[model samples]
Target: MRVLKRLVFWMFGFATLILVTPVEALEKHPLNYVDPFIGTDGTGHVFPGAVVPFGMVAPGPDMEDRGWSYSSGYQYQGRSILGFSNTHISGAGIGELGDVLLQPSSGTKWTRKTVNFRSSFDKVTEKASPGYYAVTLKDHGVRVELTAGQRVAIQRYRFDRSGKVQVLLDLQHGILFGDGPRVLKSEVKTDAVRGEISGTVWSKNWVEREASFIVRFSRPISNVITLPARPGDRAPRLILEFDLRQSRALEARIALSTVDVAGARANLAAFGQPRFDVVVQSARSQWSTLLQRIEIEGSDREKRIFYSALYRTLIHPSDIADVDGRVRGPTGQVIKAETGHYYSTLSLWDTFRGVHPLFTLIVPERVDGMIQTMLEHHRAQGYLPLWTAWGRETWTMIGNPALPVIADAVAKGFQGFDKAEALAAMIATSTDPRPNAPAWAQRDWRAYEEFGYLPYDLNEGEAVSKTLEYGIGDDAVARVARHLGKHEIGKRFEVRAAGYRHLFDPSTQTMRARNKAGGWRTPFDPLVPTSPMNNPGDYTEANAWQYTATPALHDVDGFRALVGGSSGLSRWLDRFFSLPSLGDNKHLGQEALIGQYAHGNEPSHHIAWLYAYSDTPERGYEMIERIARTFYSDRPDGIIGNDDCGQMSAWYVFANLGFYPVEAASGRFTLGRPLVSKAKLHLANGTVLLVERLDMKDVELNGRVISEPTIDYKSIMVGGRLSFPHFTAQVPKAN
Candidate 1:
């Protein structure tokens, strides 16, 4: 009996050991239950805002453009929100406005001055899913819920706080930086605007939006808000609110339809018909799936904020319909409901920098929807959208960056849109260096697509810098076209690919802009960033020097030339980032620091990856590893810039995986330092791809020389294919 008992005990011990219970029993998966308040407390960079997957705009808070460029969403600064607009810029950098604004106000006349609606009494709870957001405005004693379909917005506002409340609507609101308007219409209730909306930014692309309501408050407001008789004499924005009491229960359902307003309302009435609790539950479940995709072991606070930020990304494209998926389009014309789904409101310039890219990783299927929307907008409006707010494409930035976005998607193997149509769009957009062009104009980058260099006369950008940096996207498009069997087109692109040297000036030893006569600009300052035709040098949001090392075309080879030779280039790059700043005004807004590296923006997101493209793979690993451990933390200070949708996070996810997409739309990735050692991608294909960062210790966070490096990382894919620098694996001879 004693021997048998000993044997049983030994068996039990063995089982327990093999179970491998780490420090924690995985008590909560990263996505199990997440608090939605972490990112809402600061720059409000991450809005607890709501929308559909890959939506164009989101209806949430606006800080009146007080913070950074993308602060158009909910801001952490204010107490009473102005109102929710049908159009909003997503993941932007310099910030602007869209069309269709509506706000809940107390007194009669709609005021442009911000109203103070602070409440010591209640709190707001916002739960966001793939296509919706719900919030209970506590002080107002109201429960408000919202959702987006494809192009419409539906709002359900419940009144209870005061018992006798009014729901106000204002249409005279939109945020524009310089000479433009954020608002197109300002009125109370209407028959068709049905609370209709329409307009465009300086960009020439047109937009349209509408809002409708189905109030089922516990009680109705005895007093109605005083609004204007005609919208002509007023600012084109919307302002109105519903009043209620605190003790009573109020519930509302909002839906969005990319088809039309009625369709939007219908979609809301249908899909959103589930009990409020049910909708909330569904949203939570969806969030669970997205968050669970990547489980991180971290503190409770970090998890809350991380989950909250992820939720914020889904705020746009809110439910806009009842059940049939019908929503209003930008023309204010009610259209048939989307067969699948339609989404709107994309601040492409800003999001293209990060947010959209991040979505490509988490929700790739939605990418096709988002990309098609941009193309459709191009067909309807003439030019590709810049700061697409709600349905209006508010012209903000310079480049029609959808090129890069489409290229990236194609490279990642995403589908849903017609590839031929997409290719047609890309090839058309290849040239015509005019300040702006019709949507279908730039079919192909004119001469030498690969080597197309930006002339210094463009006045903006690191003109010459954009020439080099932009080649990557051109090459990316060419790669996809070639893969699709357009070899003739590919051959042409291959030759143009090396044309990045057209702007190179050996005298200045940097990429300089060439004039029509092939002469380099005499006065140049790479550090002084400027924009097109503007009285500046450099590029938009950054300096010329900052964009110089942008090895978008092909890093390994590009670096070789910039430094004169591979060996010399490797040493120079190592020491270059370690040097001090030439100190220019380039440090504006999110352009915070400069050690010859813009930790504040996007162009440098891949700067550290340059080392991996070099012969000293060890140096690349060390730099990336150190940066991951330093710049990215699980704290409020965790992000270096406005999460710019998901660009910042994508950079984190990529570097952590030990590789980052060198060009936004390229199939290539340059190895970099990684945060985690190993990760697996759950691709659409049945195949599961694994990435191992090997060992990356001895990282130099403070830019100090790396005294030690544990890993030798060359720019290679997880599949073991050499990316650039032309390293070939020779077959070993049999012994």
Candidate 2:
């Protein structure tokens, strides 16, 4: 009987050990949970490639097809490989930057056209991770592996049954959508003795830019043949042949720079003679370190989705500065970065809402550098970037969104940047107009200063949307101005920020377009989505319903008053989601709709969180839960829309943690439902914040019960524990 008791006790002890072990310890490495292909299909538009976090060299396979779907150059549905390019913009609506293409062929004839050298690959053989991508070309039996450093792309090719292997270096290749950028000029130099190929290509795409690259090969080159440019192609191509009679494997390190080929050479020399495996390991380590910041306890699928979303969040605002801190300024002049690091790929209109706020929490080190880069942009271009890539302004989206980012940094108390200079840049960007700016970029400062709001008749289009957006920017400037003790500037911009109230129509209970004379525009349809590019309605990529709640970010109390108090606001929200969606329109940025709430675009991202101000705060949590469950998954088509340089993914990361930056520059995060059972936030200030869902409505910060539905950035930074003690066991059903 004693022996039986001992056996039972031992079994119970072993069970306890298994149950008590941390989920993170029992599972695979954080890097293993990241699925790079999650957003590669449908409208996700993210690339499945080898890239270090915010690396300049996103080396990936470029597809044969050239259009909207191939924005990242690689789509999950694509079957053919048109070589690999060293640079690509991930999750961009407009495609560009597929520079320095290298394709390996095992044919007897030398081909001039890219189609002749293109090879089809099977999906089963293709594999990708955080920093590594590999695929086998079936036609030529050549295996391609790609990896990257911050500025260099490392490629390895293994030829099966090899005799003579050739690599085509196509200088004219780039991702072409509607009227995409083409090669304006190009120059190539080959050195057979040194086994190096260096060149520069000047192209006019989303922006006119130049990229310089130097390719250093591990094997000796047998011959160099320059291919003539095809019809309508200006830049030339080169075919480098290697005698693979003795060896079957070849490796090439391609370094890129915006400054010059000399800069590219310097970039290459920075990481001296590192093997492909070493670079891959280094990239994996870097991703693991960043992913380790937020640890959660959840199912394998949940972890995969969560970590994959986290992976996408760190991919952009790429390090554009070379190793020596030399970068091409916004006005196309070579300049040295003051901070030794300069970043581009600023999708401010989209990212300032969620991505930048997330950065302040987990990656505070990068925030200053990004702000510095924006300040430099204002100095060079006379305005902050609307949307920029590779150190040049694209002027793609609407609004003065950079203000929010700078203001958020200041409000968070990050002292790495110059506060006065940042305030000046924000004021200039908001109030000043550039002479050489595009018509769309010139936001009619004269009319705005005179009338307080951008009138429909005066502005080109998107007048209502621009007015709302400008009001948000003005609010951001006012916050910074007040913080800096500039009382007059603060009060002036504060009044300007309230300009959104003028367009609010109480009769229709929706924001209406008005002319400069304060007369409402005729034939107002609230449900119709609008854009400045195509459907020239008053909205920007959204309908009237989405913008209804946008102003709430700045002044929740004022917005509540405008919409007839808290209960009325709640009822309006209920109607907003209950109404049937117009339909899916990718071009209009309307998809993944919960009624009129377009989760696919940036405008609707924060509307659900506004439930905090309503009578039914649980309603907001319910909607958040539904959105997370319905729109996100672990599949290739997991994301509802373009990641938009990680904004979409950042939203998921914030929502999963049970809060979101409703007003990105406000320094306060509104509480919602916590998706994860528990989350551990390793803050940049060396404090760890533990967030857990308990069985009550009141939230506790480090054992202190908080009555409010919001928490400030200072509280999170000086972290301990944030407990959400209120939630249903199952997802609350929508009323």
Candidate 3:
């Protein structure tokens, strides 16, 4: 009897303990789960820097190596630290924008070579969170802490021993990729009375543009030494000396603008006398607010990967407008952004597939601003941006990629931008000839209009890829036209959208290149890949097998009929994935292979989810699970390929939520298996959406069973619970 009473007492005490524990104590702040270094190594090409979400200035360490791997100016494998730069490009294949290099050194004299000032740091002392990064310089015994506001980079240098300190400013410093220095013209001026130094650098790299910068110091400058430019140097360097005997620390604020030095000064003044720790806290708070929008139930590792990807998706299409709303337009003229801001760094080809759709759900406010920016670019340049960075068109990628993003916004009922003007811009970009066209843009639109497709003989290269991409763009234009009640224009583009059928060869069951004489090109191989840079083949960064299965999101029934029935389409997909990948000669864009399905590239991103169009969505679930398990992790080399300004990460984010936007402009998302057991989407519409995976086959939205294989965007935005069955009924929720 006594032992039984003790057992009851123990059970009672345990239940009481559980009841008293606060629920908030069990959860961690979203910022704690983000690891900024996940994509810093391997082919990820992402920078582990200190910058707010969509901020203009990203300050990070530039490594000794300036190769393709260091496109973001920092590589995990590199050991030595070149000076930190105020601007950087995140996850770009081509390196550019390493401007305004600053190095805090113990040496007082200016060396002719900048390499002498480089320091070696141990990896153990390196630390990074969302908005803060810190490292210890081994040679000088100084600790470097970096933080940022929207347009300013706050840097704090703490010395172990106080004496003399010299900060070197290289006006000509910029990222290079085997091409020589990019600085065309640069000039600098120092004001000892104001404790400020300002400069302008006009560089021609990925895109030719001018950047102005101003640097403000916390302490008065003791002296300034100017280093003469060598015979081959483009600009002079300056060394500012500071006596740190009184204090062992120094702080500097660096602000940048595409307008002019006055704009840079205005940007600097916007953040008045910012304390380093206070700025760091504010940045963290901003990240936390965005990250908390989606709450999920998963393991620690899962949370780390999810939040890290979420962190990267918010890094680009950065806000480049100054505090006074002044911005440099595409023509290099100062223009005032009527929307109070302007955004740049548009990687449209990769982003239109997933990134913009994701933005409409959680961050709808930024969508209007981005659309306005594109419209502004269209006004300055003749067409929408193919690939842009720093308010300049690079003409890097092919096709009209921006149309789908705008059309998707219109279809989703976003009212922030002028829809009729957006439709006109899309039509003009599609039909009008661009000025000073690049080689890829020099195609004969007359022939395309006559033949309903771009012929391999008439077009320079990427004949099949361009035809299919143009068809997709036309479909987007048609969708917007129809929504705006322009029935005639919608009908015209609908006919043009079906032009992809002309290139589909029924014999090989693939998209084959055709000549102007209406004959198929010879020497065709479905398995062999092609690239625009190396071999100007029929496809762009892909092969026939991948392009043939391109998700016809605009017309599912027509694509199914062309491929055979649903069973035939499923068989084609099975064969596509079951076949072996091409050998080492495959294009660099093709990586992270699952059979022939390349998750590393954008063209194949929607293919895995294409299984939903067939009878077997279970197969797509299997592929998505395999991809998430194999390609992503919490390490430095986690990402399998370039983040491509967040498209790759956006794919993972949507896939994890159990659905994907197969057609970005179609307002429909096909279902897939959910990775997390439960997720809460805190949408911008002031409603909470709860998604859960249960032991059932039918999907339920707000407790009502969904009969179709897809869900529309409106239903998701309305804010309700969406429940899906587990891939296997026996499988339990992730702990």
In terms of TM-score, which candidate is strongest? 2
TM-scores for the candidates: 0.73, 0.95, 0.94
Instruction: Estimate, for each residue in 418-522, the C-alpha lDDT of model 1 and write its tens digit.
Output: 777776666555544534443422223433343266555533334554465456545655776876889887776555555666765665455667765677777
lDDT of 2 at 285: 69
Order of all candidates by TM-score, from best down to worst? 2, 3, 1
Taking every candidate in turn, the Cα RMSD to the unseen true structure, in Å, is 10.2, 6.5, 7.1
Alpha-carbon error at 218 in model 1, in Å? 6.0
lDDT (10s digit) by residue, model 2, range 1-735: 654474456445544543686776635656779999999999999988899998999999998437888888888988898899988888888888888999887744675544477789899999999999999998877899999999999999998866788898888889875654388888888888778999888988888899999998887788988777567677878889887786789888999999999999999999788889888877876787688789998988999999999999999989989989999988899989989888898899999999999999878879999999888888888888888888999888777899999998998898888999989999998877677888876644898878888888988888888888888899999999999999999999999999889999877778888998999989888889998777878899999888877787677778888887889889888988988878999888799998999999999999888888898898998888888888889999999889999999999999899999998889999988788989999886367899998876588898888778789999998989899965753553322
Order candidates by lDDT, high to low: 2, 3, 1
**What tens-digit string does per-residue lDDT give for candidate 3 at 210-250?**
99999988777888887777555777678888887768898
| Alpha-carbon shift of residue 262 in model 1 (angstroms) | 2.6
Candidate 3 residue 407 Cα shift, in angstroms, is 0.4
The local distance difference test score of each candidate is 0.49, 0.87, 0.83
